[model samples]
Target: MVNGDPSRLAGQCAVVTGGSRGIGLAVARRLLADGAAVSLWARDQAVLEAASGQLAAGARVSCHCVDVSNPDEVSGAADQTRSRFGRVDILVNNAGILGPRAAVGDYPHEAFETVLAVNLTGTFNCCSAIVPEMVRNGYGRVVNVASVVGKDGNPFVSGYAASKAGQIALTKSLAKEVARSGVLVNAVTPSASETEIFGRLDDDRRQKLLANVPMGRFVEPGEIANLVAWLCSPECSFSTGAVFDISGGRASF
Candidate 1:
C-alpha cells in the first residue's frame, strides 16, 4: 500500500472511466480517501451502481453507465457528470479491452479490431470530451492507463501493445498542446497486473507470463491506482508528457 496525506485532493472532483472494477475501481477508492468527489463510468449498470454505492459511503461518489467505445454514450455520460458534480477536476482514462492472446499471424481479425476500438479509440473519445472543460477551468489532470507491452513488445498481444503505444504518444502530444492551458497529461505503464481481466487467460498461459516478471508475482491493481491518484492530485504540477512505470522489477527504464 502507498501512504500519503489523506486530504491531498480536497474539494476536487474526479471521473474515472472503467471505474466499476480492477485498477479503475481502486483509483476511485483512493481518490475518495484523499477527499475528492468521484464519478465512476462503466458499461455495466449493476456493477457500476454497486461500486458507486460502496465508494459513496467513503466520499461523494456518482456512477454513470457508459461504453467508452461509443462516442454518443460517453458524451452523454460526461454531460450527466458535469451536471451532477459541477465540473470534473481530474479525468482518468482507465477503460480498456484486451483481445485474445495468439501469435500475430494467427490472431483473430475481429479481436484485434475490438481491442483497438475499446483501448485506443475509447481513450481518445474521453480525452476529447473532457479537455475543453478542463481548459475553461485552467486546471485539470489527465492520466491515461497504458501498459509495459507498449514499451517492450509482447509477442502475442499485438493489438493491445499497439493501442497502448498509441496512448503513450497521445499523452505526449496532448501534454504539449495543453501545458499552457494548465491541464497536465501523463500516462502510467504497468506490467502484467493481477486484475479480473487476467481471468480470461488460460492457466497455462497465465503461469508462463507470470514466470517472466522479475518480482515473481503479478502487480497488484492498487499499486497502479496509487500512482494514478497522485498524478491526478494538485501536487502533480510542472510534469506533463511523463510516462510513469509501476511494474515492480519488470521495467528497467
Candidate 2:
C-alpha cells in the first residue's frame, strides 16, 4: 500500500527501537523498502534475529540488543548503529509497553513507573543519544509512535495513557528545539492496531476498545507503517513538533 520511489531514502540510515515485532517491525520493513539501511533495536536477540531474517536485506540491516530504558545500552546501540551505517538520519521511537489494565486506584505503582521508564524516558534517552549527531549533520527525521489514548485518555490503562501523553509532549518540545536545524520531529498517534499487544487484553475489553473506533476495526500495522515511512522521508518537510492522527476518527482534536 506504500508505493513510492524506493530510492527516496537510498543514502539514509534509520534506527527503530523495539524493531523486533509489531509496529516497530512493520516500520523497519517499510524503511528498508524505501532504500534506507535499517538497524533494529530490541531487547530480545532471538526476536531481533527473526525480524532481521524477515527483512532479508543483507549488509543493510543490523540488530542491536538494547533496552531503550537504559541510557548506557541506548548509547552503546547508537554507537553500533553508526558504526554499521556510518550515520543515522532517521529515528523511530516505537518502543513501548501497555501496562496492566486496571483502574487508577488499583494500578501498581511499580508498573506505572516501569511504563514511564520505557515509553517516556526511553524516548528521551534515544533522542538524547542520537539527535545531537543529527543536529550536527543538519538533517534528521524523528517519529515517536504515540497512541490516540494519549490525547483522549482511556479508562483502565492510566499508566500507558500517561506515558503516551508524555511522549507527545516530548515530541513537540524537541521538534521546536530543532525546528530550524533541517531535522523534523513529529508523532503519529494510532488507535488500537492489530498487533501482539492486543493479546494482553480480554474479550470484553477488546470489544470495548474496538467499539470506540468508529471504523469498527483495528488499524493495520502496514497502514501505520505507510504513514511512518513518509514521516521519515525527505518530503516530510515543514512539519515539525506536530502530531498526526491515524486514530480512525477517535481523536477529537
Candidate 3:
C-alpha cells in the first residue's frame, strides 16, 4: 500500500473500471492506501488476478471480471461489489481504448464503433448501474478519466477524441443531476500518459504528441492517481460538473 493518511477514506469503498493496470491500477493503489476498500473491475481475469496479487491488500480489495461495455455485466458486477464491500462510495470510470490513429475519413467504421462502445457507452453503463446507489446513500464521488484530445481535438484520433468528449459531457450532466444529493461527479483530462496506450503510437506520432507538452515529458499514472484520489475524497467537496486537467502544461484553458 502507498503511504498516506489512512483515515482519509476509512469506511469507504470504491469501484474502479479498467483497474488492472496503468492509471486505473495507480488510482486503486492510492485509494487502498487512503484506507478505502476497492473493487477492481476489468475484462481480463488473468490480468485482474495479477493486479490483485500486486495490491496484496487482502480483504480490503476484491477483483471482478467485467466488461464495462456490457450493461448486464456492469449491473452484475455492481451487485457483487455491493455484496462484498457493503457500499460503493466512489466510482472511477477509467476503462477506455485509444482507437485507430487514422484520419476521420480513413478510420475504420468497426474500430470507431468499438472505441465508442468501450469508452463512451461503457462509462454510461457503469454510471447508470452504480450512481443510483450513491444517490440512495446520499454520498458519492465519480471521476471520469477523460483525455486532452477531448478538449483540444487532436488529429488522426477522431474516435478517441469523440469518446472522451462524450465522457466530459456526461460528467457535467450527471454532476448537475446529483448536485444536491451529496454526490459529486468530475472528469480529469491527462495529456499523453506513458501507459500501455502508447503501444498504439509510432515513434513519429509519439514525438509529435510530446512536442505539444510544455513540460517536455509524459504525464505519469501516479500523478493522475494523486489528482483522482483528492477528487474521490471528502476534501474535494465544492467541485462537481468540473474538468481537472493533468496535462503537463499542455492545456491552454
CA lDDT, every model vs. true structure:
0.88, 0.94, 0.95
What ranking emerges by lDDT with the best candidate at the front? 3, 2, 1
Listed in order, each prediction's TM-score against the native is: 0.94, 0.97, 0.98
| Clashing residue pairs in candidate 1 (N, C-alpha, C atoms within 3 angstroms) | none
Pick the winner on TM-score between candidates 1 and 2.
Answer: 2
The residue ranges of model 1 lying beyond 4 angstroms of the native Cα positions read 1-6, 200-203
Tens digits of per-residue lDDT, candidate 1, 103-152, equal 99999999998898899999999999999899999999999999988887
Clashing pairs in 3: none
Which of the two, 1 or 2, has more lDDT?
A: 2
Candidate 3, residue 48: lDDT: 97
Alpha-carbon runs more than 4 Å astray in model 3: 200-202
Give a tens-digit lDDT track for model 2, residues 1-253.
Answer: 4465678999899999989999999999899889999999999999999999988989999999999999999999999999888999999999999989898899999999999999999999999999999999999999999999999999999999999999999999999999999999999999998788767677887799888788888898889999999999988989999999998998998
Displacement of the residue 2 alpha carbon in candidate 1, Å: 8.8
